[model samples]
Structures are given as C-alpha cells and as structure tokens.
Target: MDGDLVVDGNITDVDDGAAALIVLGNLRARNIYLAGDAKLVVHGHVTAETFVGDMTDKLVMIHGDLRATVSIFWNEFCPDLVAGTLHGRTLAPAYLDLSTAPIGCLADPAPEAPLSRLLAPELLVTGAPGPDDLTEIGIRGDALRDRLLGGLPLTTTP
Candidate 1:
C-alpha cells in the first residue's frame, strides 16, 4: 500500500504492505498491521480492532474508535469522538490533553453514571417522565450538543 492507497470503501487487510494506507472515506475493518515504515492517513472515520505500527504525520484526524498500540493525536479532528479507544506507549504526549477532548468522555454502552447527574442542577434537570417537563431535558441536550460541536468548554457544575 503506497502512493495514496485511497479507499472509498472498507479495507479488509493492510498489513501486507509497507506503504501508507490513505483512506479517503470511512474504513470499517479489523486487525490492521503495518510494517517497514508503513503509514495510515484517514480523512474519515476508522473502526478497527487494532493498528500495529508507528503512525506517521499524514495519519491525522480519525473520527471513530481506534484501539491501536498508542494514541497521540485524538484532537486534530472533531472534538466529538463518538466511540474509540487509543492504547499503547505512543499516547503519553496527548494523555493530558485528552481530558478536554471529546474522546475523553466516549462511552460505548453508556456509563454507569446517571444522565441527570451530568447536567447542572440549576437547569432543573430530571430523569422522570412528565408532560411538558420533558421539553426542558430536550433543550438541555441540544445545548450540550451545540457546545460540544462548537468546541466550547462545558460547565459540569451547577
């Protein structure tokens, strides 16, 4: 895989080549291993099992989950990291920065914490189902989404 291996679809395997895997679109694959100075450059979401190799600079901005051996750049793309996990020794530099990144709160099956607890108490938030009361919750959700998308810092306090 070299000279811009652009894939508009999914890539089953990319471990055989020592070139850069540049995905122009989404990459829905598993077990991606690169060797001999291989690189990965994805312009879209990449859902994979594991990525083994030293990722180069071109490999920036991933919108999905990546359980690689390391995670260095998790904020170069959108802040809203839907679901993903970066593992390995290459994530030390970005560890502290992840706290402010969207990837920091990525919950797959939903966390054990209650949703109401995540919002401000002054927002009059609740988990119960009411007639017009539910509208307030919806508004809060919208606000949160807007803040996240706008890359604005969220206030967790009441």
Candidate 2:
C-alpha cells in the first residue's frame, strides 16, 4: 500500500458489491478489472502503468489522483473526485459524459495554475466553433496522459 504496487496480473474483485479496496499509498498496475459491484477505493493515488482492462467499469473510484499512460476506452469516463486531482495524459473530451463529467468550473474563469496542471486538459473545453449541439470532443486520453507523465500541466492561454 506504500511504495509501488505492481500488479502484473489481474485485479478481479467484482463480487464485493460496493465494498471499497482502500489503499493507503500509490498503486501501480498493468491491467485492472473491476467487475460485479465492487468499488476500488484508493486513499492515496493510482498509476496504471501498462494498460487498463476495461473502461466501462465504473466501480473503480479513487479518492486521490489517477495517472495512466495508456488510452482508457470507456463508454463514459467520470471518476468520483473527492480531494484529489485527475492526471490522464490523453483522456480526451469525447470520451467524457459532459452531462455528468465536471469538465470546467464556470465559477472560476481561470482555475489555479497548479490545480489545472494536475487535471486533464480535455476537461477545459466549453463551446468551441463547431456544431452548436456538440456535447463531446474527440480527444485522446493517451495524449493527456503523456502530458501529465511528461510533467506538462494544463494552462489557460490563447
């Protein structure tokens, strides 16, 4: 639960039924699969190094930040953010359920620089020059993941 938790195999705890697998430290895994109704609750943070098993699994919830280097294909990607931040290099806007995903804060025109960097850039898009009814943008999750991995933070600039 401390250092790096390298899970080279599979994490299948789909029968827990809402139970939380809380981790005190960071988690480094290659492939993760959450089935049934179990919830993967991490207190520190999770770093999926290799690849995520699936993205449709919404049972994986993190209290801390999540850093992934690969593309996570999901029907919808919306993490239950408590106090931590989101750092996916390429998790694009198109994969987000804007209706439920908290992309940007309308309250703050420009969010804090530090906090913005820790989160995905795709979450900052509003109404661009496109379809008026456009709800999602086609952005790559790996791109955002790379930026976060490369230590590039999201910025508010023209």
Candidate 3:
C-alpha cells in the first residue's frame, strides 16, 4: 500500500498503526512523529527544528544514502545535532539559551541507542556530573541510507 508520505511541516500520522514517515523533502515543525511503532526517516535537511519523544519513536536513517544538514532538538536548551556525515562546523554543546525546557538528550543518555551514537560524534551534558546515564541519540543513516538515497559519500573520523 505505498503508505509512505512526504511533507514540509508538522507531520502527525498517529492514525495509522506502526507507520513510517519519510521526509524526502524539507520539513520544519515543533513536533513530528508517528504513534505506533513509528519511525522517522530524515532525507535532506532540518534546520532550527525540534522533535519530542524521539527515544521511544524509533528514530533511524531509512536509506543510508541521503544526509541532512538539519539541526533538530527535543528541547529548546538542549544539544542540537547537525545530523549528517559531513564535517566542518560543530553544533554548540552549551545550549543554555534553551533554559525554558530541558532538552531531552541533555538530561540522560537515551537508553534506546545501545550503540552509543550520541557520544560518538560528541557529548553534551548538562548540570553536575556523577555517574549519570543518558540514552544515546543517533543519525542511524549508515551505508544503507547512502546507497538507497544516492547521496554523497560519508566521511567518519576515528
């Protein structure tokens, strides 16, 4: 049933059970998600954006081909990730400006990311530190997304 959909703003498809939303185009919204086993596939770029409840949302790179220059966050004063394979500039780790709402990632490592992708590219921690646990957030756009999306080759530094 070609159930995939592409949109540009505030995507909400909680109606369907366990659905996948493909963002092949540009999108900007305060919140975007699917209610049932929902997964978000970011294709291009997301700038000055935010997403809530990404931990349980099953976020991952649908096709390893495409890369994004988007900066998205779960909270205002949280570390925003410029998700993509390219490198050059870095997202500010100290997001004190987002004082209104504690960024989801800033609180604790997202447990879903067992692979620890959040600490891989960078680590942004808030408040005092003492054996804290934060779930890992990730741009699971591995080599798979690159081939499917037919995007530029990714470069990772070790």
C-alpha lDDT of residue 110 in model 1:
30
What's the lDDT for residue 106 in model 3?
Answer: 24
Model 3 collision count = 16
- Identify the leading candidate in terms of lDDT: 2
- Residue-pair clashes per prediction, in order, are 3, 15, 16
RMSD of each: 16.3, 9.8, 15.3
Ranked candidates, highest lDDT first: 2, 1, 3
lDDT of 1 at 32: 41
Q: What is the Cα-based lDDT of residue 53 in candidate 1?
A: 30
What lDDT is reached at residue 80 by model 1? 31
Residue 69: error of model 3 in Å? 15
Candidate order (TM-score): 2, 1, 3
**Candidate 2 ranges with C-alpha deviation above 4 Å:** 1-5, 15-19, 50-59, 71-73, 90-158
Pairs clashing within candidate 1? 65-84, 69-87, 69-88
Q: Model 1 scores what on Cα lDDT?
A: 0.37
